[model samples]
Target: MRSLIRILTTVKELRWYYWGIIICSLLTAGTALLTPFIIKEATDEVVASLQGRGGGLSVVIWLAVALLLADLANTIISNVGGYLGDVMAARLRTRLSQLYFHKLLTLPQRYYDTALTGTVISRLNRSITETTQFLQSASNNFFPMLLTLVASLAITAWYSPWISLMLLVVFPTYMWLTTLTSKKWQKLEGEKNTHVDIAGGRFAEVIGQIRVVKSFVQEKRELASFSRHFDATVGLTRTQSRYWHSMDAARRGAMNLIFFGIHALIFVRTIQGVFTVGVMVLLIQLVNLAKQPATMMSYLVDTAQRAIAGSKDYFEVMAEAQEREGLADPVVGARKQLAPGQPMIEFREATFGYEDGDNVVRGVSFDIAQGERVAFVGESGGGKTTLVSLLLGLYQLRSGQVRVAGHDITETPAELLRGSVGVVFQDASLFSGTVRENIAYANPDATDEQIERAAREANAHDFIMGFEHGYDTLIGERGLKLSGGQKQRIAVARAMLKDAPILVLDEATSALDSKSERLVQQGLDRLMQGRTSVIIAHRLSTIASVDRIVTLRDGKVDEIGTPEELAQTGGIYAELLALQSGSKRDRKKLKDFDITA
Candidate 1:
């Protein structure tokens, strides 16, 4: 209930619309209440005329017209209320979606490390949708129902306190019955949501990686797993539905018994001459009007439960700690000036790891002067990428500090730090968009001339022009329409456009054929000019020209020197160099150092 109220309050800007809905609902209820009185007057006139002591047919005709106008008014007003409700609901959805998306953007990278993409998407869609629907329904149905119940009871009590008392009895009784089942129903709904989210997550995963699944011939296995999750939801639904309906049946039965007694009392009193036939008719109609809310109670409860469950999920994500970087104002196109003799980039005793895992990088320290090209080379899982991630401030270090441009990254905003660095990874990570858009992603404000210049520098211009649409050509998701080399070149073009002071290339050429590697490396070499460059490479040949090489072993720096110096040190770099050279003497020497080739 608190979550539901919080969601409602989130759209306070739409309060005027809410007020309009309430006013319209009250008017609709007013028209409905007027009908019974109007009909009663008409009936009483007819009765008096039959007894030859009435005003005439004129009175009845006027009353009938008034009733018609009232019905018409009710229809118009109720439709207006529904319109307001719908507009408010849509706007609320827009606001809530924006908030959720903003929260997602601000969340630390660590949160995403364990969260599945599909699950995250599923929760956002389901929770916001459910919340919007409930709010709309409350504005449209719940408000009007409450208005009708209150007005009906007031008029009824004026006519007969006993009948009003009986009508009031149904509300608390029905609510109590609903309350009994609500917690249980919500529990079951939450359980079902877990299965649904998992299924949805898997569904998206399978679709995204369909090629891999097909290659492995695991389509049946994936489908079975998806079906099993939904099947569990079905079983939960069966139990939940049975429980809810059984309780609804009991509540409805109770309502019927109470209304049955009320009807009998009205008939008895009219027959006893304690009330006129017209009065009896009015009382019966009011009782029926009061019964509408009772009938809708079960549906309202169901919607409320779903909304509550979804709101809990929504708020859970919102409650997560957002990145401190997100709190700072964006520092766009504003590079912090470095002092003289300061390293362009520095890592001092930096130690870091993923959530609750052994440290991937420990006590690692390094410094890079401006315009120096350095490379990190080691076996896989040597913390080469981790070191770069720390430098980028993607994850907070467990200890020590990383500084860029002489500013401690812990104190500086990540946006400001990242704005100074350009990165190109092994995978291109292109979006499904135009050739122009992918390159401009690094710098959204880059002009067509600038974009083309970057592409030309990356050697992607000729191939891009080969497409019928040229720069405007739509790349499929993750640039699937392009070859591996094409994607890598486009990624290079993106980083080139960034034109940051620092550049990091993580195995950027490792995934390419020799010809492709040569093209990408040429582009990379041009991109690295006059920048502090950090290269992570598995292919030793690529780093032969770097000013220095840092070799990592077990998350610690084993050696740091120029390529020539490291080639003679007989360390990890030397061992790798020797293995790549395929020299039998170096291989025999590696055994003396207890190193496996």
Candidate 2:
């Protein structure tokens, strides 16, 4: 019962389109049960009268027409019910997909990091497909079956109350058996879903690293691993199929036994003259009508249970906690929230982590004045990235505060903060779109002239125009068609177009050749002319241009000073610069390939 309520709740969220069909199906079931009476009348009045030489031909014709019309009514109602099922499935799919996409926009970054991509995709694809079909069937098919059961019982009572009561016993007994069988099937389905998810995740992982597998001669290994999961999926599915057929055959046999018993009973009663031939035929037809609903009842229980489980998963995603919002009565925009001419960013004893794991950034405090260019230099896993993430409102602080542009990031709306900051990472991600579209992504309202200007400033326009499609060519998935340097240049152009008050670069030029790096450095200098910039780089020469350097170790700031001042101190920053430059000789010995080539 609770499951039914949950399934209905999901259905109710969609606008009612097939609900009329449900009403029509019930009406048709009632109309169909009336068919037996017409058949009985035709048998007694039409055929019997012709042999007896008493009644007129008109009685026979009228009974024949009545039976014909009952059949026609059944056909029309069944067609309506089928049409409604299609419409309901269509609407349910659209609404559920929309809800899923909307929920994705609010999920925390940590959720995405920990959850497999294929698991999320399977839930939206396969799970939603099953759920929508089940919902449509429950409304259009299940309701009609229930109505048929009621109408069949009523008609049977009119013929023989004792026989009707005996027939009614089949309904509850089959229902109980169906419920038990369906419960077992639901467990198998859950197991089947788990294996299916594993298979999808494995496939996605293999495809993402196909080049690596081939390079390492591990294709056979990957195939063998994939085959193992595929076998598990098939094994579970075949087990489910066998169980389904066995239960189906058993239940069908039971129904047939009741059907034959009713027929034998009617035959004996007719022989004893307890009922007329027409009355016996009517009871037989009624018994057959009862079977239709009884069989459907079993299927309805199975579908209902599957849909119930699917609905629970659907709502679980919908009910995920959303990102927090600011107070209702609050400061308006970024400018209004921040004090006039104060520092653009400040971290006051802030601490944070991805989850319950060890804190990645702890007790970090710093302030960046307006228009100041600051650089963070630290070893890998030294919390440099975590601090930038917190400043961008990607993760909330556990204690203390991180203020951006004078407004607390945790208390401020993320949408507003995102607009005020432009960021470029080491990966330099680009969507599958034209050069112009990718550059203008941060500011969709950018004019063609503004796009060209930004591209020129980022030193990407010359190479972009070299292509046959110029700015119009598709970049393929994640800009795979372009060279690494070309992708990074486009990313730089994107940051330039946003023209935000703050710019962030996390090894943005590390992928470029020396010449290209020089060009990108010039562009970065121009983009950061007046904006406050925070950069993270391994090349000590590149970050040396920033006004101040901040060095971190083990989630704590160990030192901060001007580039020359830090270099003079022989502190952590000086040691890093020495270590990075010492590797320059080895780096130069490597081949110089232009990432844009």
Candidate 3:
């Protein structure tokens, strides 16, 4: 009930539409109530004419015309109310969708670290859709039903208070019955949603990585897993449906017994001349009108449960802590200039970790002077990427500070800090779009000439022009149509187009062949010309040209020196270099340090 109320309150901007819907619904209920009264008047007049006490055929004809007009009015009013309901529902959906999407954008990066793409998408679609549908149903039905119940009872009481009292008893009886099942039904719904989210999350993951699944021959395994989740939902549905229908049957049985007793009393009253025939007709019609709400009680409860469950999910996500960077904050056109003589990037005693994990980067302090080039050389899981993530402000440090442009990152807006740095990850991470769109992703306003210049600098111009459409050529998702090297070059071009003050190349060339690596390395060299660059590479050869190297071991800095200096330290970097050499003596020496290639 609270979730339903919250859903309505969240959309207070649409109050005018809600008012329109309410007015139309009340008008609809008023017209429906007028119906039984019209019929009673016509019947009474016809009986008077039969007894020769009526004004004549003309009086009956006019009453018949009154009935026709009332029915016509009811038809028009009902349609108008329905149209208003539809408009209100659509507007509500639009408002809710905007809210959910905006929340997704503002949520912290950490929320997405463990969240699956499909699960997130599924939750947004399912929760909002369910909430909107229920709101629409309630708006169109709930008001009118309540009005009918109240008005019908009032009129029935004027004729026979005993019948009115009987009609009133049905409400609490039905409500008590529905309330009994709501909690259990909601519990089952929550469990089912978990399974569905997992299934949907896995489905999206498999589709996104179909190549891996196909290569590993795990299609059957994935299909079986997907089927298992849905199958579990079916089992739950079987139990839920059985329980709900059984309870519904019992409620309906009780309603029948009450209505039977009410009708029996009405007949006895009329037969005893305690009420006239016209009064009896009106009373019976009112009783049936009151029954409508009672009959609809079960359906309303079911829909309300679905909406409540969905709204809980929606609000849970909305409640997540958003990053300091507001979605509306402009990342571009708001770059903070570096203070003179300040390091372009600085990590001062920085410490960080993933959720529920030990620190991945601990007490790591480093500085890169303006226009200086540096590289981090370490094995996998050595905290190299974790450090870069911290530099980008993707995760908050557990202790200490990372400064960008002489401003502590924690004190600065994340947008301002990230806006000054450009990154090209190993995966390229291109969206499905035209080549030109991909290059100008960061700076959408980049001109054709500027885009071409960046592409050329990244060594991607010739290959892109080789396509039939040149820069306008379509690249499939993540640029799947392009080779590994081609994707890497485009990623570099995108970073180049941003033209930020700092650049981080994270294993950018580690996935390419020798020929492609050399071509891409040439572009990297050109891109790094005068920027403060940070490179993370597993292969030691790529960072040899860097002015200094920072080698990490177990999340702490093990060595910091020029390539020549680090080569003789017999540290992690030297041991890696030795393993790369593949000589018998170098291999034997690596064993002394407990290092493995």
Candidate 4:
């Protein structure tokens, strides 16, 4: 009931179309039910004419004309009602989709982490379409059916009240049956959707991580897993379908019993001379009209239940609390000239965690002064990424505060703060677009000259020009066509072009080969200059001479100093350096690469 009400409220704005539908539906019902009475009048006129009653021929001709007019009106009204239904269905679908997509964009990042990709996509794509179809079917075919049922009963009761009593009693039983059957179908539909979600999520997860699957030779195992879910989904759906067939059969059987019994009663009454031919015809027509709603009861209930069941996930998404709005939008159009002094970025005893868990990064404090370069070097899973996440305002702080340019992260609008910070991640993600567009992503409205300059600075100009279409050539999904260094360089160019006051380099060169590493390292050096930069340092050599290095141990800040000072102390930072020193190849490469200098 709540679901139906929600759908009504959503489409309430388009009530005029519904009003149009209602009017046409009433016209259609009136025209159809009136046919039996008109035909009976014509038959009586003919009988009188055959018997040589005076004035019979003229009355019979008028009666014939009336029946023909009723048929034409019925056809026209039905067509108009159907057309209005189509219009209402279209509006419902379009509006519901808009609501869902708008809600999706406002949800926080954690929602994506916990949710399955396949389930999310399915709900977004199919929920609105199915819901509106059910609503339209109800309004067009099932809802308007009441007009036929009600008018038939009134006319029949005028002739014989006993028959109307039987109809009233039978209506409730069918409705009860429909309600009971619908409850079971709704649960089954939910199970079916769950199985489908698993299958789709598994397929997408495997494909997206195909490299890992191939490396580990687990493709056969993954296929088996996916097949199991698919088979289960099919088996369950078949069972549900069989159940629906049985209910449909039951509905039809019930309608037939009512039709035959009514006809039998009318025949007996006619023979008794208590009922005339016209009264019998009216009863028969009314019985058939009552059957319209009964005949469609099972289908109407099933479709409504299925649509509501499918929307379970869709409603859950809308119910999720949206990310808080930031205090301001990005300050663009004209660049602000920032005066250099003090820490541009600061954290004081900041802490954060997921859900009810203990803080993943705790009691951390640091400062990046304007135009100063700093690196955070730590072992894997040592809270290096958490600190970066805090800086980016990806996670709300569990305690304390993260201040960017003297504004608390929570108070500052995300886009406003992020606009000043350009990030280059280790896993460089590029959309399917031309080289020029990809580089210009940071500033979509950047001029061609600005794009070329950034490309040259990142050392991406020559490679971009090498393509036949150059900047116009299409890069495939995730920029798979480009080599590792080429992708990294483009990412560097994008960040550089933003020309933000703060720069973040998240393992920018760690994933590249030795030759590729050197090229990418050069690009990073140019991007880091004259800005407040924080490097999530993995390759220790690159940040050996940075302004400072912060070493983390077990979610807490352990040490902070220059590389030389930390190496001399034999602290956590020294231990990390020693671990890398044992690898002579890493040592030689570090020596060859002078990235920070």
Best candidate according to lDDT: 1
Report the CA-based lDDT of candidate 4 relative to the real structure. Answer: 0.79
- Tell me the tens digit of each residue's lDDT in model 2 across 1-597: 465455456668544555577678777887777787888877777556667853778887777788788888888887787787777778778877887887878776766777688777777776677777776776666767667777878877876787787787787667666766777788887887777777787778778777788999998887888788778878887887788778877777787787777778889988999988788888887787777777776566666666766666667777877676655323223444456678888989988877789888889998898789999877678888888888887877898898777677777777777778889898988998888899999989999999999999988999999999999989987899998778888998999998888889888887778887888888788888888899987576777678998888788987889999999788777665555456766444222211111
Question: Model 1 over residues 1-597: C-alpha lDDT tens digits?
Answer: 999889878778988998899899999899989999998998889999999989998888899899999999999999999999999999999999999999998888889888888999999999999989998998888889789989999999998999999999999999999999998999999999999899888888889999999999999999999999999999999999999999999999999999999999999999999889899999999999999888988888899899999999999999998866635433333235665777887889999989999998989998888789999876568788889888887899999998777777878777777888899999999999899999999789999999999999999999999999999999999999999999999999999999988899988987789899889988998999977899987466788889998888889998999988988999887777667568787565544321233
Clashing pairs in 2: none
lDDT of 3 by residue, 128-160 (tens): 888888888877787677787898998898888
Winner on TM-score between 1 and 3 is 1
Ranking by lDDT: 1, 3, 4, 2
* Models ranked on TM-score: 1, 3, 2, 4
For candidate 1, which ten residues in a row score worst on lDDT?
A: 326-335
- For every candidate in turn, the CA RMSD to the true structure comes to 2.6, 3.7, 2.7, 3.7
Error of 4 at 409 (Å): 1.9
User: Which of 1 and 4 is ahead in TM-score?
Assistant: 1
Better of 3 and 4 by lDDT: 3
Instruction: Write the residue-wise lDDT of candidate 4 on 274-352 in tens digits.
Output: 8767667767777878877877877777777777875666677778987678555353321244345646878899988
For model 3, what is the alpha-carbon lDDT of residue 327?
41
In order, how many clashes per candidate?
Answer: 0, 0, 0, 2
